[model samples]
Target: MTIKKKSRVTSLAAGRPPTARKPKSISRKATKALINTHHVLEKKKAQAIAKGDRAAEIAIESEIDALGGIEKYQLASLQGQRLDRGGDSSHILMEWLNSMDSTISSSAGAHLKMLEVGALSTKNACSASGFFDVERIDLNSQSDGILQQDFMKRPLPKDDSERFDIISLSLVLNFVPDAMGRGAMLLRTLDFLKQPDTQYSSGLRTFFPSLFMVLPAPCVTNSRYMNESHLETIMNALGYVKAQSKITHKLVYHLWVRKSGVQCPPATFKKTELRPGHSRNNFAVVLSGSSG
Candidate 1:
């Protein structure tokens, strides 16, 4: 969804205290319903366009409107992310960062800059850690700190000063409706990451520039066209090497370091099925042209 900037109007002074304004608890079932319905409608719309079925495309649009549009989908997603709901993925990221050497804290001359895409709240673990200087953005801003902007529309960095040490795509890649767009999004991260250099020489802490990504477990585990090995192949092709990963029953988290001079895989990736099953999903990441 393309989000336009809107004035943030609030009655905080007269309303209840800020802590009392928490997102109301949403049932897991209801949240899943909203998110699933939105994905289905978006997929149908994409298929209609592919087949040149204008009538079907219009029908899908109406269905989406009836579902309360992208705003409703975003709200459901945000609710699902509330800390009480096992929504914040940054806790895993923080764990990985703490395990790394030469840790950079606020005391360091510079904090590691992070571009957090699809950020839902300004209070996630990463924001509170005091280790990262985060730039939060989302397609639809739910709070004051997150900028209402699409990651694809973000301007390209001019040089090192404009780049970041890490880019977090927590549950954001799966939000793109199409596979090709997902691949493009991954590649785009490389452009925003700092180029390899001697550790601490530039006042930055040790460690390579990295991409921290989180996705629904099914996107890899139960997809017809993608699996763990396939995903690793794709990332390796893009000059990334997995540094850490943790897979749960519902979610998968990965941290891929941007390697300095590795060559991309010899072949391109497409939606060819790697696993055949009627229940498998269509999740895929298809790269066009060269990777990295």
Candidate 2:
């Protein structure tokens, strides 16, 4: 699909240099409405693509365009993350990292390299803290430092030297329109995370590869096909041991450490109802060809 030259409005919202143009002021309620509606339309578009329903896909595309397109959706998301607004989630990630190892913040030698997926701002807490060497990327970048690239399409590192010490997937998994895609995304992380060299000792375990993930609360708490336990099962099967987690009324945060040479469990997580509430959402993650 061809993306037109960025519209004037999009250019203002896009990740241009600070002098380009400031985004227009938009109320939080309006911003949220745009984001939520865009998410609904995106899911519809994904389903249409899955079924090869070109007509439905085009119609959904029209709706998304009317709703100001993916560019606007990304802008609203960035606004919502402003310090005066909900505050950047990366603050939580920074907190968890320090809590895990205070030395991580002070040790210059431990300048951990990080890949921040779906990044909206280059000045978020992690970037500002100077604790991590952050490489930010988004499908639609909104700042000068963040790369306009799809994480799913990024090339795998050729070796451990090129792999990152940490990978941040904040609000990224939920944005994936399908469960299988989410699973594949999770599995793909293993390929980019730096595996420890035999010469390295356990003393520097704080620098080991890890995944810092954040998602909206309902994706786990109120979904019929997913919950905390189910998510744990999937991550465990993928050899990620939960190191830290925090659940707020609106979001869930987790830090997962990769376990070298761990065996994947033969469990299959299908879209069966684990919770019996009619109000539950349809969020789920499915590993391909895995069986109980």
The digit string of per-residue lDDT tens for model 2 on 1-292 reads 9988854644543665654567787789998798778878888999999999999999999999998787788888888888798698989877766665555644546667899999988888989887778899999876779999988899988877678888999999999998888988888887888774423336446436789999989999999899898898888887778888999988999988876533444555667789988898889999874422
Each model's number of backbone clashes?
0, 2
Query: Which runs in model 1 stand beyond 4 Å of their true positions?
Result: 1-23, 198-207, 261-267
Off by over 4 Å in 2: 1-20, 100-102, 105-108, 196-207, 262-267, 289-292
lDDT value for candidate 2? 0.81
In model 1, the clashing pairs are none
What would the per-residue lDDT of candidate 1 be over residues 112-135, giving only the tens digit for each residue?
A: 789999988899888988888899
Best-fitting candidate, scored by lDDT: 1
Q: Pick the candidate with the highest TM-score.
A: 2
TM-score of each: 0.86, 0.87
